[model samples]
Target: MACRDDDYRFLPIVDAISAINQNVNLVGVVLETSIPRQFKGTDCFCTVKIIDESYSSPGLLVNCFGENMEKLPSVHSAGDIILFSRVMIKSHCGDVNAVFNKKISSFAIFEGKHGTQFLPYQASANFHPRDEDNKFLDCLRKWLLNRNPDESISLFGLNEYLPLEDIRVGEHLTLICKVLHICKVQENKWMAFVWDGTDAPRANMRAKKENEIENLPPLQLEPTPLPRDVLLKFPTIGTILRVVMEDDNQGLQLLNCDRWVKLVNVKCEKYAGLWRCMLMPSSKLQYLSDTEKLISESQRNYEKRLTLKRRREPFSVHLPPPSSMMTETSYTEMPFVTLMDVITHPKVTGKFKCAVRVIAIRPFQSEDFCSPQGIYRITLTLEDATARIHAFLFAEDSEYFFDGYPSDRTLKRTRNALLGVMIPSGRSNEEQQCAQRNPPWVQLCLKSYYTDKNDKWGTRKYRIFATKVVD
Candidate 1:
């Protein structure tokens, strides 16, 4: 992988890491990178920390900005080589930094393999690499090969790792988990649901007070970037911890859906009776490779969860026997039918028992479960192998399902167990497809009828009744 003397001749003469007060071209190994985040109106930016032979202890920081992500450095892994062209040299907070010039700054990223061919997998549209750049890339690869891999690419700070399920309130700790989904809550705020395949400890809740229910505002909606189908694939039975990242532009740019990441210095606290994790000012985020030990542990837990679920009552048990239900109003013994049969039955009004799994629940937050009338009104998206439908769980049925009146904190765990938690099954492609399937089946009594019996063709609705979920 050694480069010839002629290859060195084409490169511009510049100091390895000491160049200051002047624009200079440089090459360095990427040590860290921020997730790209949108700023201003349409412009996006990210920061990359790099190191070279001359600057070994600490890395030099480079600030990259572009009209869009396409023009920024897309550094996917540590130890990659970045070739900067015409970057402005500047000082920030008493530290030298490279400021990207939109008009003249350009970058090219090369994979850090020792003997791979000299080629840039990612580069700006205007970047045109000459033979000299290839030589520099080769030299960097050789240097990377000779250095100790552990010391070269190991992430710094907050080495202690804690499981999502083990986090205690008021504790600031680091955690490694897979990011199932990231959705904007509001301006400068995002909610990232992360899971490590283990169930989170239930939060402590206080008894409800009469004042708690009075003068509450109407329920409002929170915007999420994920679509229905994507959300439906989230894990049904594990602890999907909610993480709030506030005003963290660099951290936001660093995260992506389905990626495994290490969250450092996250503050865990209880909010509205549910455990919540937030990123503090000192918190740092590092992307983890698929081979990370914590990630593997999470995958094992995920698989075990699915195995336990399979051992539950089979869907066939819910299939109706030869003797059908005698009468619609007969509470003695009603035969169970598939969800499809319940929905498409010829009767304009009918009561039936079906086997289904709860997929998505509306209101998103448990706090909104109470209606203005002080009754619990929740909508559940239930699905069986054959069909998917929405069924209303309100009034007496809602209270019965929850075993009592629903309160924000007291029954948060119960509500989650009934509605199921949302997290993708795994980070790998194959396991991801498996997450799309519905969870184990449970028997539910559903009443299907038209809003107006006179107009049979009008809106049809389904209501869940006489059903209770047991832990």
Candidate 2:
């Protein structure tokens, strides 16, 4: 049968193992095959042992039953690469297995030179080349080449690392370790304490400054101390890392000019998928797993707790007093401009801080706006005491004002507000009252810009992009 477009794309066997109960696609070389067998009063089934280069040791067992079994080519044998789609992943004991769905799953055997041609058993099935698939195959080929005994210091050889305790001073070594803690030691400099699985002291490594880091190759996928937001997303503590370092006077440090540090955990297919979802708008996060949803909820609650704790704590008397220069810095730097100033001075385009009342909020029509897919936009009629103007918030920015709540109800309310209609349900009395207030107030940090609307007036319109929610 034809696989649905929603069927999972091909993943490494390791990822298929992690994503149990979900549909998966896999491409593997068949190591062994079994003849079709029938159980009493049940459908005939066949089994095949296949291996993808991503995993070593025991290969994956694919069980094809019913129509899938009937559709298997008569000459299918070992050494053949097959692409399986829409197969359900199930855990049997401690091992993962792929079970074919009778109606929606299909397989294609790659049959030509360079493995370009895929012959599908069923006409309804669609098979096409994917960039990720090609990249995976290329990686697999490199791995296979490295596995040959004659190849010395192969590309995949870095997986083998010497024990941290075994290294002597002045000796260059590769080691797999986990980051235990990271702290900022100086401006643009950070220290990381790492521990490999050995009876050795934790290695302290310092990050190179921008000037030194600039000398490294651009294509190197090495792990470094990331920005605060990016660092929070990574499984830093307890996640494995591969690094090539030298035993120096100050214990182990990264080799001065090479791209040797690699964060291994994020390379897992499941984590890679989660990272992609994070980059998307809040609307797109719905497809994430229940585990991810729980993690996000927990993180939000923790942040709320921290905020409340900070609010309750009084300022310490021992803290140093602010300098006169520091006190005046805020007034001198980036002063908030009035809405009238923004409208009159079209050339003055930059970030502005302002407090305004939301007179009306108009949600843009999804079909009319040529926005990036999966993103939604809202227009706010914001007015200060002097003048009123429109500010636009898209996707992530809109979600922030809505208190990180992304739902059809929120969209409906914005749409209704644009038409001056009331939905009048689902919300509590307090919320309804708040919505009916004379004017809703909001504080904003906006990016000001001017655009020619090409209207009957034949003049440019001033608009602001809502970059942040201050209140």
* TM-score for each model: 0.57, 0.28
Clashing pairs in 1: 35-253, 35-254, 36-253, 235-423
Off by over 4 Å in 1: 1-17, 37-43, 53-56, 114-117, 142-159, 168-173, 184-191, 208-227, 248-255, 264-269, 275-284, 308-471
lDDT score for residue 235 of model 1: 56
lDDT string for model 1 (246-345, tens) is 4644445336778877776678886643466877655655666565455676688667646652311122444332233211222326655656466556
Q: Residue 384 in model 2: shift from native, Å? A: 99
Best by lDDT: 1
lDDT of candidate 2 over 397-456, digit per residue (tens): 555545454466555454333323342579775554344323323345566654544441
